[model samples]
Target: MASDDEDECGYFYDDEDADEDGVAAFEDDAAPPPERRADYTGFRGGGIGAGIAADRLCGLRIFVCTPNPSSFQIRKGGRCYAGSAAITQESLYTAQKQDLSTVMNLLNIKQHQARALLIHHRWKIDGICDCFDRKGRERMLRDAGIVLQENNSLASGGSRIPVGSAKCNVCFEELPLNSVSTMDCGHCFCNDCWTEHFNTSVKSGKKQIQCMEVKCPAICDEGTVRCLLFGKYPEMAKRFDRFLLESYLEDNDSVKWCPSAPHCGRAIRVGAGERYCEVECPCGFSFCFNCAAQAHSPCPCIIWDKWNAKNTDSENIKWILNNTKSCPKCFKPIEKDGGCNLVRCKCGQYLCYLCGGPTGQEHTWSSIAGHSCNRFKEETAGKSLDTKRQQLQRYTHYCDRFKIHGGSYKVEMEKMGPAVAQRVRLLESDLNLPFAMRDGDWLTRAHRRLLVSRQVLSRSYAFAFYMFGGELRTRPADQATLGVAKNLFEDQQERLEHHVEHLSKVLNAGAPAVHQVENLSKVPVAHVPAMPEAEVVRMKQETVTLAKTVETLCGEMYKCIQDELLPLLVEPMSIAAYRPDGPDKAKELAA
Candidate 1:
């Protein structure tokens, strides 16, 4: 913490913050006119002009700005600063000197409100619209009073007195004596319980992790969650530490283009990842970061003894480059643009350029008279599309948002998570809904997984569509699409059918009749654990044989689409139809 006098200026801020509150909104569609800017100019040490009430500001980050290089000087407490970017104030005063971007975040207010507070206060805030502008003053007043305060209802706490020992809210197990720790929910579950809660939350595989509280809108604090969960379960502890790695990548929307063709010639670059896990390049070129393709020409290791040695010696470099074929008589270089390896000398002698053998026209080697170009071309065809070619080029680029796979789970989640989460909450919260499923955390997670399952199934169908009846682009008619979709569903049926056989074998694997029990709690433990076997079998069946997995659901969905939706589209599509398997046809559908 800086002293009050120092905070009147500037300070170094850390990157742990997501900067969600009042940071500048990310601009995707527009870039505002630069010349329309207003001036923001001032960074100084000043006495606290007015006090801001805690409740007045929800998020605010303040920065004093100055355009001047070295003109103004302030020495109320005998301190010298180089520039506003360098300014530092001590204590609460230090925060007082933060950048406007920071100020907005700290206060959690819109620009208008921040301006309003500055005007109403009539403080020496440089960024404020000056001369007591009424609009600005009102905004400042609202912003200053907008404190971030919330009352979360999901209580978590240990048993205090009469209700026996504290139990784990998560696994429903008993908490260890004297070691119970409470979460922000104030519901005290044991360390193990909360650790599992966090692990399941992260592994439940959500883009934005939230508390277990139903309909509660609090974004759990990292510091609090970390303090509450560490040391109980080491696996969760390790993962929580790893989750912070996102901080190093400060911003999203970062991307690098493929270096190819019109630009730097098909080169690839990435800040990290090596290659795709599943797909391969069409060019038969594969590479990771450290080493992609082999070097074409070896470097000269020996040093020159004199100045004449400094000359480039293009002929030597050409030799290094392996320009094997040359005019035998003229001694000039010859490059074959398209054809094979046999060459005719300028002096009319014929020879095989690749093997330096004799050509058929009276030009002969020691034992053989002629060599054919056809065999040479055949031998080198694979190298034309080889992993490396000295003449052809390639390039690559790095961007955080640019994904290796055209299909990306990371990208899909950002678009889908919020909608899914909201839908789940709505399902759980609504009282009128007749769904029999439990309206609780685990159920919500299971629903989320179902969404992912459905999406993958759809993608697999698309892949099958491309593979079986040619591309969808060629045959997009309802009939053709359904024809391809049938195979996809069949493929899934085969997989799940296999699983059904596997689980059935488990039943007959000498476990006996004890495995068929319905309620394990109702049955004596000495008798056997019956319900777990059934539950496990049920889970597997639901994922596949029970007809809930993506493959089966996709088949049903495609059937519905064909039977219901296709009929509606068919007439209009016929009216607007163009030639099949053409770009114009694609345009009409898109339009």
Candidate 2:
């Protein structure tokens, strides 16, 4: 029998029996000898070994095949995994039909009734089934206002038409039986009145119009609505159809429309994961699904919201508060960049920059004559001055670092990105270089990590500003502990910042030198100097090492914030999970 550790590895195979390819194929009933069985204990925990196992397990013969890559898949041991899908306007019907078909098949109901139940329950088919199991099927249908006809003869138009004229309840007018229509609920109304009601409902944007009878819970049949409005108002009928189709997104909890400017006309359906997770739309716009804003992970939605509101116009306001004073006569801000305390505004009002009071025309360089308003007559003025000074100082400290990283990111994207791409092209075209040396994917990956990590670094300053400063503070005792935690966090942040800058410097330094090729218009090819193999290998190793280091640092910083600093807060805060590859790219919806 296999030992416990071997069993934990989840593989029964022998390394010696395998071919030179290193792939151990297992037969259904063939057990390897005890001495020859592979010791796969090293693969028990996560690492390169575990990654290999995951990939290999997918190629096993027992698992069922699925064409849709985003569809949920089951491993041999019953682990379920699925990727998110992008629901576009073209695939909206197909996306909705999956649930509709499931519900219809389970309940043996028509499409209209299934849709009514789904809309009422917010498209949770599993919840509906569970309810049906707990409280019989009839009660579940009735609760969602779904009524089924027991006999065809009892339904509308099933019984013979009335021999004489019938009185319509809505219009109270006598109409021939053929001119009146009876709904599933057995409420009869004149065809004209019913058409007007359907038209009004459609115009009002009501996707599911209820029965016209007073206090009736039954939803109006979609077919009835379409037939009534198609003749007089074809456009309204089209609008009604669209409204019903879009209800899948508007009402479902697991799906959301992409929050892109100018509208991407696509919605994302998350098959798994929390609602707060971040997703990238196929249109190349990434956003936090929870708040429908640009992707800001590792920062809770609430904190991100507060940070955005606080930062808007904050730098300009702080500069005005710290570096300028209002003119005493005109009340317009005047920044004294140079000469003396005696400053003249564009409005022709001369004021003392220090005291912010009007000065006479006759004034010296150092002091404004008869404008000695610097003395604080009241203690209130002294306290106010101190408060403003502290606030300005605190804001400046955080804003300077934030702006630095933000500006660096923009510059790197605009300048270094194209430079790296060009360098990579040059290397690929060099025939003297080996295939491995020609690949520049490491540089591209490192550059992407640099961009994302720099964003996190910039936002971390904002988080620290609000977390430790006056905006949010804990008890006196907690403050001491928080100070220690803050130091630890800053240390990690500083280390990450140092490495990110180093990576940025190396990538910005430009790619390895390629042989200079001088060409003439008449020459088809130009002879170029061969790059040394050692230099090529060394450059490749350095780039790969730096990329891996940057990725590790970013992961560590995220883990530190999630595990350490956040727990110290009094109120609970949640951030989106760290995704090293960046935001989750939504797969195109399957046809």
Candidate 3:
């Protein structure tokens, strides 16, 4: 198996001067000290803020224009040996290329000092030439020997190409029918190989996908994933393409955005205006942009995935400028406000649907996605105080619902608190008083506990179900929530009967004054007639007091929740299991 794995060295860095450790081929003796190296100011203000990596100087063939004292002898086997400073890639390129001997010609670096800085440029810098061409360049970059694929494959972990240069998955051949990229897990079989695999999975009803590379979390690029595989691997390709087409038609134009929120996620979304439907997320967090819930449409946002992907643009700014009026990819309305006219798609696709133009393939939405028309309804929506007021009203509504839920639960639980306390007190009073030590105390204590449990649960249940109007909003009186409330009500009825039974003998005989069961309800007790209006009003007042007691108990529990339980919910998110920062937050609510 180890023999099957490819060597770290590749064609690109296999040159005569190419050192085994890529660093040795590129060290320069005469260079600036680390303290004087230039500070990183983010790549040309393009938003890709990358710092200069110090290790790079040792990896290239360095050339110095002038000699200086900063220059040091190369370390030969840990000892400094004088080696004349080189003036070109050719001289240093020869002495210690592709061997441990180059590292032996170590920089005259001090024990604690950082290595000297030589000429450095990012990959985009022009006129930078390598001894190897493009293909060779990619291959050399692969030899760093560490791959970050999630699935730990027995293979080279998807960082390196498959054994024997990865034949097409379908045809089992080396050359691809067209352009292709290996999965992150280094499963580099041709696209044809994967199309069949997708067909099998999708058919078996698997909705999620990751690399075939063991446990990789990396998702296949959905758009061309099928095309690449099917275009070459005929059998699986045809079946998979059919599935893809079906998916495309039923789908509204969805754009892929990053799932990371206003962060890196560029998921696929669809629709027009403040409401978008059927958003497909690249991070697998598909949900509606409107209502911020899961996507289920006929009622989708209808976003164009190709429109929002221009996360960083240099070459495609003009295309975005031309397509900013309406969405360029779908010819649908784009209602963004106050930005340059760049509208990148969530998917990789980038063409203007409005003028049949193309958007900047990689630009910020603000760069070119300026509002082009006077037609966005959501725009000028708050121009009227009434609309603004309504927006405020909705915000308040959601907040009020949440608060009412908490309050109602607390209030209900407080009612049981006093009952439980009184029962315990009554039991204690009777124990020390001129009365027999009753076994009934055990049953009373249990009843009190049972009451406390019911009180706590009943209120929270009501808040979860009824208070939010989730029950009212649901059809059939919101069966899911209603069922819970109904069950709680029934449980309370049963508990009342049970406690009454335990106190029955004492009630008929008349219990001791210290622990009387006189006023308590019992099944075997005599029947009572309906109360008059005044009596009903009095009863309602009693109910209110009982509710206050319940509320107090609820507050006590909430204190515990807030002080201890909630902190454990995690950071950047509450409850640790829900909300915006949570992984499933996008899918948690219904849109």
Full-model lDDT for every candidate: 0.31, 0.63, 0.31
Which run of 10 residues does model 3 get worst, by summed lDDT? 110-119
Regions of candidate 1 where Cα sits further than 4 Å from its true position: 1-193, 203-208, 246-251, 255-331, 334-591
Q: Which scores higher on lDDT, 2 or 3?
A: 2
- My TM-score estimates for the predictions, one after another, are 0.22, 0.64, 0.20
Clashes of 3: 85
Colliding residue pairs in candidate 2? none
Off by over 4 Å in 3: 1-166, 177-179, 210-550, 553-591
- Candidate with top TM-score is 2
Measured on C-alpha atoms, candidate 2 has an lDDT of 0.63
In lDDT terms, which candidate is top?
A: 2
| Local accuracy of candidate 2 as per-residue lDDT tens digits, 1-591 | 124223312321221122111112122223333233222222222244334234323233122213221122333343222446799888987677666655554454545677899888787654564566566667788888876542223333334333356688777899986677655555667878888998999899898888788987667666666666776787887798789789999898768899999999899876433576788999999998888988887677777888788778766565844644578788777765321235688888886544566776544332333433312233433464677666655655566556556767776666666656655665677667777677767768777887888777777777776776656545555777776777777767766765676677567555422222112223332332334667656666776787788788778777777777777677777677777777889999865
User: Residue by residue across 16-114, what tens digits does model 1's lDDT show?
Assistant: 111211112122222222221112111221222112221111122222222331221221222121111111111112222222233333233322233
